[model samples]
Target: MEEERGPIECRVRVPATTTNFGPGFDAFGAALRLYNWTTLRVGNGGSAESLPPMVQEAAEAFGKAVGEPIPSFECAISGEVPCARGLGSSATVRVGVLVGLNELRGRPLSRGRLVALASALEGHPDNVAAAVLGGFTISTDDGQTRVALGSQLEFVAFIPDMEMETEWARSVVAQTVSLQDAVWNLQRASRIAAAICLRRYEELSGLFEDRWHEPARVKRIAAWEEMRRTAYGAGAIGFYLSGAGSTLMALAVGRGGEVATALTRVAAKRGLKGICRRIQAENRGAKAWLRRPSRRLA
Candidate 1:
């Protein structure tokens, strides 16, 4: 039998993700350098209060799945991952909670089980898979996921002054798509995988266009056309809506600063207010570690 230990403390950090990447739709996602942090510890005489709703729910689900009497936990969260900007902020929170709890329970759950649990909680796996597995991920409807690493490209995200709820953005997407558009996106999605593998960054510009969700969703963003044009003019080779987006992201190598400045300047001129930041893809996903309490048996 395993010996008892001191109070367990777990800290988890999960990266933000931008899903779809123009044409992959609900299948593709990339982890970003931006992150959300959550710390969890076993506690006494208190409810799981003050935690994010997703975190609280995840804790309950995990406890039930493990069939263990779960101890009350205190959770604290802090990060720059903005909510409702299509950045997978909720995924970070959910993934962090699951990971932290798993560690506190001595990590009986496998990574695959964790992925499945997180995906189930998310109702979709793209963002959760990327947050859990890191790098770039493609999730299939058959409950399978493929991941690839190595993206040297930098990203410039132009955040808008307002927020767009994911439900509303999802509701706006078309229910039907033509076969031609489906084939078009499928070919490019395949090519994108190859391009990222071969480090063929120049081939991405053409691949970034989509005939499906982007067309329907673009109408919601004011000055979308102009923003796309300006992003390219500012030396971004490829640009796309970040997830469901109140944020637009441009892909570049050495031109992130230039692209970010141009995006902000153009948005300001168009009376849209928000900040722009240059960030890179994070290959490492969420990490959780146990910090044991100092030994003092007084």
Candidate 2:
């Protein structure tokens, strides 16, 4: 008789991503050191019906992509990325489950293929591209381009005690823009991508100006103007909405501490309770590994 196969457990660590840096709306994203760890245990008699909707979707997609039926599995998620905060938290979960399932299936898909699947699930490529490839990613329909960010660069994120749903945020944005505004945003977005790729940090200044999305969304945020002014005054190179925002991010070279402090203080004065964190770019992206099954006493 053939021996029975034991249960397999796969764990994945997916980095948090900040997308839509300035005018690169839905096109730009970078991975941060903050992460969410997800574990998938297969052959444990776990039912797919018990899984969250997002996880189930990911698993179903993975099965379809690989041309195999995915076994029922149990999933556990733990991490620091907060949901509905424009921090790519949902992307982390989707990517984590996909990667975890792939690992358990003998890695039938390539990383690029996984990225494509993830982008589809995310409804955009920016966050999923960054989460999969790490560093800084510029995602266009043509493909994705990545650039390594130096450790000196700091991302100071001010996460308010509020949640802004991505769906609602997208609903507020206008579908039309003036010719001048379109040109302006295109120029800045292109320059910002080049600056990061060429390591021209100085050129990044003034290039984060956006004529789309932020204008409509900022109105919902309390003391938005003051937050931007304070961040700049405290040594931020560029400050902008992280994604669809309740959390704002500021780029600083070495002045992250000052910027974080200023933003925190200003938020408090505005009666907005929140936390500030200084994080660096995570170049390693998401990683998955199979856990060795434990043996029981005979």
Candidate 3:
């Protein structure tokens, strides 16, 4: 009889995501170069209670989706994505663990199925879709669509020192909106999606305006108008909130560094105290691979 393999390891790399994209609330998202990695090793007898809440939830969902009992495995996560800053840090972790678990079990779930699972856990599909598929994604309850962006585009992320919980942010939004406001958002969102899909970057200007979420969330961010003016003054084509709040993103072309510096200075001057990073959209999404096998010692 062949000797049984012992304790195989799998590693998954999932990119961070920025969703909402102004008027496209819960609809648009794009994967960024920032990443979170999760490594899973089987036969370690890891307990679900010990894992972070998000990881545990992901593990449970994975088991139920695949119709199998989750195996005993240790999980380790490391990455640059900051938590609760409107960047899809939670999605990255959830995707990482789910993909890592799937890889170790020989990938029983397809990428589409994985996206569906992650979206269900996240309570929204935008961030999870982009994090899983890469590129620009438009997500809805029915399905997700992706568009590849060019190298010329750059995203200047203004990450604040403070953190805003997604749940709290959602609580602040009005339960209902005016018909005019709803129509305004719909018009802009449709145009923005078309602009991105067609690569008409110039047309993206002024399309980021929204009457849905930003109007309410902007009040919570200190010096929002001044920072937005600074970003535009520095050659940003479009500016808006990344996800919920606390991290504002500027869409720029060749002037990313100028925009980043301007946003940083303005934020500090206004007492917000934050940093700006110039990042590119990641075309490739989450990836998984097995580590070299190691034998258990007797």
- The lDDT, on a scale of 0 to 1, for candidate 2 is 0.90
Q: Write the per-residue lDDT of candidate 3 for residues 105-129, one digit (tens) a residue.
A: 7789998899999999999999999
Clashing pairs in 3: none
- Model 1 agreement with the true structure over 181-287: per-residue lDDT tens digits: 88998998888877776678878876889888888777878888899999999889888988888789899877878888888888989988888988888888899
Tell me the deviation in Å of residue 20 in model 3: 0.7
Better of 2 and 3 by lDDT: 2
Q: What is the lDDT of residue 248 in candidate 1?
A: 91
By lDDT, is 1 or 3 better?
A: 3
Ranking by lDDT: 2, 3, 1
- Model 3's alpha-carbon lDDT is 0.88
lDDT of 2 by residue, 1-298 (tens): 0014766778899999999988999999999999999988875567889899999999999999988788778889999999999899999999999999888878899888888999999889999999998999999855799989998889999998889999999998889999999999999998998989998887787778789899989888878899999999999999999999988999999899999999999999999888999999999899998875563211
lDDT at residue 130 of model 3 (Cα atoms): 97
For every model shown, what is its TM-score relative to the native structure?
A: 0.91, 0.96, 0.95
- Report the poorest 10 consecutive residues by lDDT, candidate 2: 289-298
Task: Write down the TM-score for model 1.
Answer: 0.91
Candidate 1: worst-modelled 10 consecutive residues by lDDT:
1-10
Q: Pick the candidate with the highest TM-score.
A: 2
Worst 10 residues of 3 by lDDT: 1-10
Q: How badly does each model clash, as a count of residue pairs?
A: 0, 0, 0
